[model samples]
Target: MNILMMTNTYLPFVGGVERSVQIFTGEYRRLGHQVLIVAPSSSQQIPSDETGVLRVPAIQHFNGTDFSVPLPIPGILNAALKQFKPDIVHSHHPFIIGDSALRISAQLKIPIVFTFHTFYERYTHYVPGDSKALKKFVIALATGYANLCDFVFAPSLSVAVELRRRGVLSHMEIIPTGIETELFLNGDRRVARKWLGINEDVFVIGCVSRLAPEKNIDFLVLSVKKFLEKRRKVCFLLIGSGPCEDKIKANLKNEIIEGKVIMPGTVTSQPLIDCYHAMDLFVFASKTETQGLVITEAMASGVPVVALRASGVAEVIDDKKNGCIVENESCEDFVSAMNWVQGWGRKNNLKRNAINTASKYTKEICAQKALTVYEGLRRKNHILRNHSESTWETAKRLIKAEMDIIKNMTRATGMAITNK
Candidate 1:
């Protein structure tokens, strides 16, 4: 099958959604399908021999982190769609690129599949005042686009539930984002620690995410401070960069936790996996995630996690089993959970369980499941289009019948009012 994948951001912009789309397009190409990616042009574009990359003009902005807002490139995109003639157009978000894909799919009369990769509502605070109104608008936009798609793919059950709550009653499928298992298998802990320049005896608690406000990194810092007030030997490692880097550094200095907190800046895959290996525990306090991909990455590296019970996080973590889940976002609760993990002396058991859980979310499994959804949509679209009677005609008749019933009810109420 020929597939066109659309996303607002792509390579050079490192995030879970971008990485997930890259993996999906890569796996689809490996399976003998022609895949084309349409993303906004960034500072640099990587050429790919396996799949085609079409970069569109977009506005680059710094919303605490780097991101691109792609403009309407329907002319170029539709021209490419005509040449490529993809069987399925899979879009990764409900923004500019995804909206473009929706319009193209309708115009071309092709099946469009959408994946809800991020929870935009959670980040409404970043938008100016009347955030509640903006959130409603975003949800309405999502509902409109999703209803037009052949099928909507949600990465987690929580996301699907939220979609329904927002009035998106379209056909939905829950498919979790996956990891590259081979890259995160068991390795020599001592070697990994040596590579990260960390001492073997220190208890290292770390987080790997963009240093942004929504991630609540400050909360993690506070939790670390609380932990240190009781115990002094623990260290914290932060492994990503964003606008909040300077603020976080300042806060760490002001709190006098500078020596305990380590910011290694941004690093690629291998170094990131190595960071996970060097850490004794992984702590993530973000509430904005639809699916915390780093949590699974850490689990795959045989490290237990401490995360808030937010969104789809529970789908991967079992509190007290793989790791501890803070039931609330309170600093005290987070510190208590971290202390509990330390007190249990069950790190080995937790690590083993986490690794076992991670095995279930490999890239191959995710790709296959997504392929199945695509096939199902294709068959459904084929059946609907090839039917003897037009679906539009059938829909019109149903609408007329409902209208007649309402009209009769109104007439009866009017007569009753006149008689009274």
Candidate 2:
């Protein structure tokens, strides 16, 4: 099967969506499928030696954000795609690169699959205006994009229900971006503790995520600080980096200076996995997560998590079972939950249950389930352009694609204004 996957972001930028696309693409190829990824052109962080991937021209770091905006499609795109003859185009975003994916699918007359990875309404602050209307437009825009797709991949059940509420009429599938359970399972606790210069007899509270405002890093930092002050020989293992790094460091300045807080900015690969194994508990406070990817990774490494009761976090966490889920967004509540997990005899049972939960979302199992559906979609597919479409015909198709995308945007705008 020929599968064409398109997204705004890719590897070297450590996040959920990028990791999802990377894992799925690799798994599909291993399963004897031809996969081609159309992504933004190589940035400073991106490597030049990527295979089964097509790079399009893009403006890096748009509006001081981590995202890259794809430029207009070059002529070479049509030529390359014509030869590939993709049966299905899987889109991982809903704007910019997503718009480009929509156009490409329209031009080829193939069915497009869209993954609802994030709640668009929660990310309005990234834009210039960042008004209530802008949030509405973003929501409507994502709903429109989902409706346009032949299938919608909702990362969690909460996301699926939200999509249905926002008027996404397309067929939906609950396929999470699966983790490699073994990769996390094989990490060494002793090795990670030795490298971090921490002793074997210390309680470690850990968090691995991009430190951004939308992620609610400040609240987490404050809550963790309060938790640390009340305990002796307990450490916080903070990983990943972003704009909010300085705030976190300042909030926990005395603890960090005293060697009680270990801040390792953006660790990956074996070291990252090992770090998970070294932790006794994982802490997450992000309200915007579509699916708590890192939560599963920590659980796979035999660590229990205490997190806020958000969309994806609620479903995975069984209170007094695998881990404790805080009922609200208060710092006191979050800290209380953490304290509960820190109790002895409670940690071991939670660790066992956490591993059991993580086992259900492995990369191999989720990939096969998605691929089975893809095979079905391919067999029942239809196309507009044949194997021998002319250059002029392709150009005409592209022009029509532009018009369709523009109309989609307009409809979304109208829905936003009318509150429909």
Candidate 3:
């Protein structure tokens, strides 16, 4: 299959959606499919190692923003689409490149899919309007864009419900992005702790996410402050950099100075895996994730989670099983949950369960599941292509398509068994 992915961000951006798209592209290629990515030009030059990536002209760079608006050069994009003749187009966002994807899909009579990656309601501060009004507008925008797509991919059931509630009547699939489980699983904790200059006796609580107001980092700081009062041997490691860095640092000035909190800016690849290894527990305060990919990464590293109960975090964690879940957003509740879980009696069992939960969401499995959805959509489109046909003929074609799908699935399963 030939696949075209359009996104405002890719690769070097170092976010969940970017990483998810990269994983999908590579996995599709490994399965003998052709993949091409169209993304906005970054201020930084595209790395030589990146292949099959085409850049659009970027017009402005907002200092604190995760994206740049690429001038929609229709002629250039049209030429590329014409030459590729992709079987499907998968867009990562609702606006920006997604609008371009919609245009090209209409022109070429191709089916397009969009993934609902963010809970835009939580990001109202970025726009110039009342928070309530901005949130309503964001929901409307998401609903309108979802209605235009041939299919919508929701990373979690909660997101799917939200899209439906906002009037997304289009076909939707609930799919989670996969993690590179082995990368985290194989990291050497001793070496990682040594590299981070962490002492063996000190218990580390870590959080890896973009520093942003929407993430509720200030609230998390408050929770950490309360938790640290009793457990003086514990420290917090805050990873990743974002627009809220300076704000968060100022908010936690005393904690930073006292060595109770460490901000490592940003780290990637093995270094990122190493950070996960050095932590005894992972903490997440964000309620905006469509799917908490970082939570899974931490679990795959055999580190249990202690997170506020919200959004996809609830989907990935079972309270007292894989990890501890704070019952409310209150600082006192969060701190209390942390203290309760720090007892160390159930720590080993929780770690084992966390690893088991993460094993179910590997990159390979996610790719296979996504491909199945794509194939099903393509088959449906193929069966419905002859609009001039009679209703009886269409019915016959639908039955034939279903039979083909079943046969293909059975044969594939047999092949896997034989190989095993």
Candidate 4:
């Protein structure tokens, strides 16, 4: 099987969407299928051994964020498309590369699957002239884009229901971003604590994610700080780095200097596995995550969690079973939830329940489910295009595609206005 995956972001950027692409691509290749990744070219060093990756030109650091704005030149992918002859195109975003996915799918008459990775409306802050209207516009645009695709992948049921509520009528499936279970399962808590120079006796409350504003880092830091102040032997282990680093440093300056707060910028692989195991409880406050991949990763390490009620977090947290899911966004509520989980510790089958939850979302399981869908969809769309397409039909399809996008914009405007 030849699979073409188009995403807005990819490695050497570490985020949920990038990790999802990486995990699925590796799994597909391991299962004896060919996968080609098409993403924006990064200034960072790409792996030298990569073969199936095609990087398009991009503008670096759009809006002071780590994201790259892709510049998709006309006919940039023409030659590769002819060579690869992808059976299906999977899009991980609703804009930029996502547009390319739509164009390519339409041109080649192949199946295109879109993953509703993020609620684009929540991220309008990155764009200049951010407004409620712009947010609503993006929401409608994403809903429209999902409808244009042959299928849609929702990372969680919360997201799936949300998309459906927003009018994404396309065939949809809940395929979560999975974690490598083996890595977390065999992690050495003692070793991780020793490496971080922390004693195993300390109660560590940790979270692993991109430290960005959209992640509600401010609320999380406040909650954790208050939670830690009451306990004499507690540590706040906030992993991952971003724009929020300086703010976190300032807010927890005294605690950090006193060694009560540890911010290890962007720890991955073994260190990340260790950090998860070294923790007594995992904490999250992001209201933006589609799958909350880190939450599951922590769970895989047998670390129960306390997270604010959000799309992905709610699905993963089983409320007093594996972890605590706060219903409101208040700092007090979040802190209280942490205390609640702290009381439970690794008891009352919490750790075992967390492990059970994580087991269901292993990389292998999610990938197999996706691969099965791809196989079925590919078989249904497996047809060779004619050497010469009719000019009228080509014109009609292209014009219609453009019109659909325009209509999406207008529809999104209406949706935004109505909701607002």
lDDT of each: 0.78, 0.86, 0.80, 0.88
Over 1-420, each residue of candidate 2 has an lDDT whose tens digit, in order, gives: 899999888877788888999989889898899999988874665665778888888898878887777887746578879899898899998888798788878777777899998887887787798887888888888888888788998888998998898789999989988889988989999999999988988999999999998898888988998888888788999999987888888778883436789998999999999999999999999999999999999889888889988888888888888888998889999988888888842366788899999999999988998887787677676433376878898888778778767877898788777855
Q: Candidate 4, TM-score vs. the true structure? A: 0.95
Ranking the candidates on TM-score from highest down gives 4, 2, 3, 1
For candidate 4, lDDT tens digit of each residue in 57-148?
Answer: 99999988888989965699999999998889999988888888888887777889999889988888889999988887898889899999
Return whichever of 2 and 4 wins on lDDT: 4
Off by over 4 Å in 4: 255-257, 383-395, 413-420
Q: What residue pairs are clashing in model 3? A: none
TM-score preference between candidates 1 and 2, better one: 2
| Greater-lDDT candidate between 2 and 3 | 2
Off by over 4 Å in 2: 255-257, 345-347, 382-401, 418-420
Least accurate stretch of 10 residues (summed lDDT) in model 4?
A: 379-388
TM-score for each prediction? 0.87, 0.94, 0.88, 0.95
* TM-score, cand. 3 vs. native: 0.88
Model 1: colliding residue pairs: none
Residue-pair clashes per candidate: 0, 0, 0, 0
